[model samples]
Target chain A: MERGGRFHTKSAELLAQVTWEVAGLPDPEEERKRQAAEFAALAAQYHPHPPLARNLIFAFLVGGSICAIGQLFIALFQSLGMTDVQASARASITLLALGSLLTGLGVYDEIGRVGGAGAAIPITGFANSIVSPAMEYRTEGLVFGFAARLFSIAGPVVTFGILAAMASALIRFLVTG
Target chain B: MVTGNAIAIRQASKRLGHQTMRFETAPAVVASASVVGLREGQGPLGRYFETILEDERYGERCWEQAESRILKEAVNTALGLAGWKEDELDALISGDLLNQISASNFASRNTQMPFLGIFSACATIAEGLLLAATLLEAGVAARVIAAASSHHEAAERQFRYPNEFGAQRPMTAQWTATAAGAIALGLPADGGGGAGWGAAADGSTGEAQLLPRITFATVGKVVEMGQKDPYDMGTAEVPAAWDTLLAHFRETGRDPAYYDLILTGDLARIGSEIFREGMRRRGLDVSSRHMDCGVLLYRPEQDVHAGGSGAGCAASVLASYILKEMRKGRFRRVLFVGTGSLHNPVSIQQGEPIPTIAHAVAIEA
Candidate 1:
């Protein structure tokens, strides 16, 4: 379904009444057709034609760099005598900290703007979601403002993640035990 | 000495002229005031505004309360300038970008006057004017205050995203103007003598009060071109603006050349181009005299991509810059087409397309 279809269906009845009153139209079908054509012409002229290949390359490069940094952090922590699992956890925590700091300093927004969803589909995006609303409502005070709104956007993600984890655990217990 | 035939002919009303309404007794804008925040005060038309706030909060606890304060200041200033008290006002028509129009509603609480809260998104000023003019022409209201306001932070949290999110905005995104504007509308005080608040009522300057009068109004139809991206609002609004302009011309039988200035509510830079190009193709080229309040509000160097927007954008510009220019005899006639994209964050998230509207009011000096 086209994006315009959503608008046309929702507004058709009311818009028909308006056009009839304003244009003094004799036929509703003809006016609707004319409007549809006009919208088509406008869409043809202004609709963005994204460069898929270029976008894919940027996404790969940015996404790979983020992962590479995480691996380096894990390796460095492991060399310091930590277990593999412990190192991985520490690396993820470090990345989350950096993402939150960048978001607070107003640098992450610029990167997300230029990189599009390339910057948003990563763990850094998760950190941003948690930090963003907290800072926005700081004026509302700590308890009702920052704390209450801290997980407004990321709360659903955390809820679903825990739910899925519990289900996986229950299945494993039933099959193996 | 006047003949009965002449009296009957004069009294015969032309109820419908195309899609427009021609007023027999046009309501005049006697006084107006504009109050803006720091960023807006730094814009190109900053000097013309009545008050420039150094702080967005205006000493309020929250951004919403700050917006309400801006509205109250604008209304009070306008009333004071017109030498009228709140008790004298027949009704107050106001709106804002906040949900339930809480900004205007809360601000009007102290006025103790009859309140009419309206919402047309960014086209609120024109809608307020249209309703106020209707009341004045019908003799239901001798004096009315029309106002609209918008606050960047309050609007951001409500309609878009959290301001602290540092979300990267697209180049198509427009900055909401943190401003409020109000205008006093009334007829000549007496039987054609033009005494109270007329052109000569500006006693401070010892010059005639040369106020602008709203002569005609064309209520716009909601038009949706199916552009759903909220950041690129100009695209969604252009078609509605064109529709209203076309309707106004068709109804009035006047071409683009009829007015010295033709202004759109807040099409900004990108939408203004689309509007001009679209009109050119239809053989109604208004590029020469066409200007947008969004484009004029902020300077290009300000980095307000696509320029300023919001209900207050056009309202502040009209009350401050445009009205002052008209009083100076710079423009004899003007047409203000206020365009609005009627969509909220919930609707956009649900994959709904934006519906748009534009209301036009013809003001003459």
Candidate 2:
């Protein structure tokens, strides 16, 4: 708030003026006129919905694309008469491996390059990080190799989830046993 | 014809407050005694550096960190060359590139002088000089030190990443190299040399740090070329530099014929040409004095695809070459402009062209 005798509104206006004075530029009125014109033209080309729309479409596309690959894995396992849970587990594993492969090859980043936010927000994105680096680190040694790292990221996630599941199991047992 | 005296050389600093934590400072002091955290990762050793360039290429980050660590060094170096103490001086005026200005805040933590913060992105160092000059001439304080800084790790984490799980980045998104920088200004009576940091001893009220007087800094005409990528900041930086250059010439009542050097912060190679051509179209001839910070760091052999950005690139170079030239009195006058593009992915994807800004300070040695 401004001190007494100087209105807050006027002080703000003055502060705006001071900014111009310091920059050695013209007064606010001139700049305002110039900005108004620039903004009017910009409004025509860019739409608020395009990027968001493009992204929504992309998420469905990539998510669908990955899901389709997962479906193929499921079909392969099911045709061989695997259990439903078995097929689902096998599909996730296949994707985890695939994600790791793209990540290692640095190809998934290419997809991200084209889609911007489109490829970014999906479960497959996480798969890429864990798998890619692990695969890249393969040359380091097998005791610490690619197959070993298949669980590097998944390792932590599973560990935490299992611990959480155990705690949840204990709580349920205490309440309903 | 000489306008001022002391020259600023070498700047470094650190940030202490706010990491994901919300901190508070007086509105006036907010700009001073501040370090910006793009994320908690920017300071000494953070994860962002590990993934981006690896340890072998940490030289740029080290120079950057040194640049951040040495704003006080540059000021003190100039002061050492000048020979002055804290109380013998007046106040410290400075700024930084953080959300809350942690760089200057952390920097001021070590010094005994008062802090006045500022924000003009890469232009703050020169802007700091201009402010220090104004105060010296205004008799606000007999001597004052001004400074500014930036960091990459912190900036990237805050602006780009909330989580690293597997975010794909764009090429236009130049990695904000991790580092810090600082500079000190003074207007002392005696020319007796040797002060903290290094001193530009020969400059009196008529030397680079003291006298030339910051008559004005041109407010740039920001142009949004509608480049949507948060990665391609050059689009905005080039125009800002070009616009600022034109504004500098027009405001000072001269053409490009007036300056021997016109330097822009962090515009790199692609930006340099765009800025030069952009200015040429305006009928402003810049045969000389048109250089970019991106051009100076590393050689073509280093293979930095797009070149460099980040507050340190310009601040460190300014501390080394430009400030050295100022101290030698090689340039009677120079126009240093720092260009920055205000951008975020949210805004870009919302289809907004990045709004850009540049600040210009004319110096005489």
List, residue by residue over A50-113, the lDDT tens digit for candidate 2.
Answer: 3456656776777677778888999999999999899989888887777656666667766764
Interface RMSD of each: 3.0, 8.4
Which portions of model 2 miss their true places by more than 4 Å?
A1-124, A127-177, B1-82, B86-89, B162-171, B188-216, B219-228, B300-304, B328-332, B343-353
lDDT of 1 by residue, B1-365 (tens): 76887555445643345467766688888788899989899998988888999988899988999999999999988887777788988999999989899999899886677899999988999999988988998899988889999998899888877765635566678999999999788885522212333332233354544668888899999988667889888778998998999989987889999999999989888888888888998899999999999899999988688888888988899888887777667888999999998998889999998999999999998
Q: List the residue pairs that clash in candidate 1.
A: B199-B208, B199-B209, B199-B210, B200-B209
- Distance from true position, residue B198, model 2, in Å? 6.7
Model 2: DockQ vs. true structure: 0.10
**TM-score of chain B as predicted in candidate 1:** 0.93
Residue-level lDDT of model 2, residues B1-365, one tens digit each, is 32233111111111111111011110010011112222212322222111222231134343233334534444444444435565565777766666656656665676777778877665566566556655665556656666665555445534553222345443334545333333444443334223422232223434434222233455555556545556656545665676666656654566766767777877666556666765766788674767766566444443344555666556555554555545546654667787777765567658887777776766554
Give the alpha-carbon lDDT of every model.
0.83, 0.54
Model 1, runs deviating above 4 Å: A1-34, A43-85, A101-122, A137-149, A155-177, B1-11, B189-209
Per-residue lDDT of candidate 1, residues A55-163 (tens digit): 6676677667777988999999999999999999999999899889988997776666555566666788778888888887888899998999899878888999999
lDDT of 1: 0.83
**Which ten-residue region of model 1 chain B has the weakest summed lDDT?**
B190-199
